[model samples]
Target: MILAALAALNVALAGPWPALAGSEDVVVEGAWARASVGTSRPGAAYMTLRNTGNEAVTLTGIMTPIAMMPEIHRSTTNDKGVSTMAPAGEITIAPGESVAMAPGGLHAMLMRLQEPMNEGESFPLTLTFSGGGKVIIEVPILKLGARGPEG
Candidate 1:
């Protein structure tokens, strides 16, 4: 909800954020990752995927050079306010719709890191879709505790 509101305000106040060029109809924006303190812990990444095509697309797989295991996950808060995260498998986006991967929601989990992700550094993350083909976006590494991409 927070990321959606921020995006809406950005569009209303300024304009739509520029999308990362892709091979198909899905465009990505605001791709970022939090800097890792060391190689022991996994890192999380976030982005928004917009579908501009007429058909629905399912995001199937993810890959990045920084980690050995990159996967999609969804975080949810239960009725008791306990938060849990689980593997998301695949996500389908309808035509003209969008899926936002923000904090406390759907996001990418970069696990088994080969090296620590430092602030101000960036890496390419490849996402494969069932209908929309594939997209490789550059995800910037922000502060260790950043909740969202830097403005």
Candidate 2:
């Protein structure tokens, strides 16, 4: 009886579990941001987004208090060897598809950083989806030049 009571209490305290990016239908993993130096105007955050649901979902927007503006961006190189970054509008993920955000590719551009994002620090980032699903996640700050999360 005591064990059962404890289990019930635990569930009650835990409340209803929300579906994060990488769980039931949508999964988000490997979320990390590049560390910023003094007075840096922008930073980048990378992550892998997976869609396990039956229907497609559009990643509508991102929000964070640490940056004045957060938007999806893509980096590309031209024939002249010049690289340019531009805003990427809504990104769609099909069923059983995974999208990777990495260096020189799609990334979350944090413009006008409110403060220096030092390494070893973590902050909250919210991702909004087209189906009214939102996921709040903590993004770890990695070294400025780190290539990926393993670094």
Candidate 2: residue 38 Cα off by (Å): 2.3
1-151 per-residue lDDT for model 1 (tens digits): 9999999986675333223323388889899999999999999999999998887778998999999999999999999999999999989888899999998999999999988999999999999876335688999999989988763
Question: Per-residue lDDT for 1-151 in model 2, tens only?
Answer: 9999999997785465344433347789999988888646798999999898887777989999999899999999999999999999989998999999999999999998898999999989888887456777899999888889997
Q: Distance (Å) between predicted and true CA of 119, model 2?
A: 0.5
Candidate 2's C-alpha runs over 4 A off are: 1-24
> For each candidate, what is the lDDT?
0.87, 0.86
TM-score between candidate 2 and the true structure: 0.82
| RMSD in order of candidates | 12.2, 5.8
Model 1: pairs clashing at backbone N, Cα or C within 3 Å:
none
Q: What TM-score do all the candidates reach, one by one?
A: 0.82, 0.82
